[model samples]
Target: NTLDYDYTNEEYDLIYNPLKMQGKKEVEVEVWDYNKVGKNDIIGVVNIDILPSKNKETQIELFIQPKNDKGEVQSNLNTDQKLGKISFSMIYIPEDDYLKRLRDAELKKRKTEQELIRQKELEEQRRLDEIKRIADEQRRLEEEKRRQQEALNAQYIKGYVQFKNISVSNLKKMDFIGKSDPFVLFKAGESSQQTTVAKNVLDYQYLNEEYEVLYDPSVMQGKHEIEVEVYDQDSVTKNDIIGAVSVDILPSLNQERQFDLFLQPQKDKKDDSSKSETSSTNSDKKLGKVSFSMNYISEQDWIKNFKQEQLRKQKIKDEIIKQKELEEQKIKDEIQRRLDEQKRIEEEKRKQKEALDAQYIKGVVQFKNISVSNLKKMDLIGKNDPFVLFKAGELTKQTTTAKNTLNYDYLNESYELLYDPAVMQGKHEIEVEVYDQDSLTKNDLIGAVNVDV
Candidate 1:
């Protein structure tokens, strides 16, 4: 018998089934809660497999809830408990056995997949390493072939050759065949030989694959030992040699030495032809007498031109000066216009202030006269001097003269003054003088009277 347990949703299901054919099977299952199970919570079973004569202590694993219904597991568990015992003969198997086998196969398949992925990574690394190794070998072979070609072109011999007493017509072709720098040798006679050295060959051409010829006739006709040296473009001497050849002087035969020479025309001869034609034309025009004064007018024309240019410049300068004067005059006129406008405005303001001050002084003078007349008519002054009476009443006073004074006080509604004998009581002459605070005279009245007072 095998015992299997599965857990779901905080609950566990235990299935006990016989493995093979068996008689009576009795299993005492003891489960101990380890991580999250409490007391009497089954977590595993001992003696889960029992046969007829044999008791198998198969510790069957029980799936306990990793978390309880509250989504938390206890840190420790209590002791084991005997869940129950089962006794039965060979019977049916549980359905969870097939499900457990399927779960084990899936776990094995996942492990195999992880191994395959690791092997693929290792194979790709090996392929990259192999590609880098092949590229390094091709660069080494190309450097070896370039060094062998320069060694074969550096070997030759050196000598000089000269020619004498041999006509240049006799030697139509000359070839110096060796690795040496050879020269043409010229022989003068059988016993006496004059040799001219050829420093180097000229007009050398390679006719075939291996032979080269010097084609200049002057070097071939020379009677000296020619010093020849073959060099490369770097001026390194590859070959040097000296050789001599005798030139045989032949007696004069039927040969006339004739040569063609070229001469250029003289300058005066070409000028004389043109002068003769001019003279002939001048004779024909003798009657007309084409007279010309060989006079130089450049300086005079330059002076005139300079004077004209100066006149033009002076005109331009005058124009510029006139424009500047006009600009300045315009600016001055603008300033004067602004000044006139400002003066006009100031004059108008002065007139307006004078008018306003005149009106204000007139109103004040009228108020003083009215106040003095009303005070005298209403018997508002005491019998002592009106100035003294006003002073006693805490009014302010100004003595305009020895006999005339201004007595004024301010009430809540209006300003009042008293002029005692200057303004009479029944028919008084109120000589009231009103002045500004600066004591400058504003107005004066002679007999501002009230009839009743």
Candidate 2:
């Protein structure tokens, strides 16, 4: 095929596919030189071989030879010759092979899509199964946990109720001369906890006691109630119901709360026989109010608290003993001080009596007749002369003898002594001495005499 060049000098593209492919392997081209003359001269003739698998565009070169009318090769060409060579391309493509390849590619795409769809379905199924398994395991674990908690709670007393100040309000007077003999009866369900009587107190505090009960949160948390009733005792008639109160056992675990509940009066004994669970009693005849506090305590915890209380009480007892010892010591010290004070007072009185006795003087002394029994001798045959002298205290008055010679008649003499009353009253002493006149040596002496004045 020959194509015309465009009007402008620009590049051109061409795509060609064969409609019929028999067995053509090569192509031939002939060129003729044309002029205004008759019979165009043969310019050249060219031949090209097709290359296998060259489906894309290709370029080729061919050498052409000039020929005359006799069909002889011309070696020389004038400057006015039209053409000298030819260039073109021949591409051969196998249509059957290309069509087979297209069909194979389409088949491979379909297979890949089917495999992806199958894998998606398998993933969805696995997700659903895992969700169901997780749900079942969670439910089983929750059931097990609930059962364990209940068992632990049942092993101990988890609740307590303390009843105190159970009294009556508008008490029905049972006696004429005195007030009614009132009493309180406390009950946990049907079991009686305590029954105590009082003589004549309107707001009587009958019982202050703590009671233990089982408290199961699953079974009987808020439903458990403690019942309290007041009754007026009598000698001849049956006990009359004063009032009754019921308090709910609160819900808690390891925790406690206190409540002050009022006792509602029940119907007359002729109407009702037992205490009702409801507080729908005679409002006008409200027996009175009951004061009590309830608490929740596990059995083990309750025992531990009891031990702690005992220790506290023992410590207080020891402190009291020490205080008593101190008081006794104080009393003994006070007695000793009083005895010492009394002894000191007695000693002072004795000293005063001694001082008064020293001021009074009353004793007297008188010298009687005195004689010299043994005198100092001056010679063996001659007798010596002797005389007696007397003295008392500081003042001494000797006796005035009225005899010429010293004789036994002259020995009797009296002396008068003077002294301070305080000094003389204690000890009034008088002294008497005898002396003899010697002729040659010192005076011979007779025996001396001493006396108290």
Please report the candidate that would top lDDT against the real structure: 2
**Per-residue CA lDDT of candidate 1, range 1-453, in tens?**
235444444533344555643553544433444545554544433332333323222333432323346534332232233333332222223456547865887888887888777777777777777766665554444444334322321111111112212211111112343222222222221222222222223323222211111222233332221111112111254332221111111111112121111111212434422111122232321111111111112334445756999999999999999999999999999999999999999999889866754433211112332233222221224221222111212223453221232444433223345433322322222233333122244322333322221
Candidate 1: lDDT over CA atoms?
0.34
TM-score, cand. 2? 0.37
Candidate 1 Cα misplacement greater than 4 A, ranges: 1-301, 363-453
Local lDDT at 62 for model 2:
53
lDDT against the true structure, each candidate: 0.34, 0.58
Q: What TM-score does model 1 achieve against the real structure?
A: 0.16
Per-model TM values vs. the true structure: 0.16, 0.37
Residue 178's C-alpha lDDT in candidate 2? 78
Candidate number of the best TM-score: 2
Model 2 gets an lDDT of 0.58
Clashes of each: 51, 2
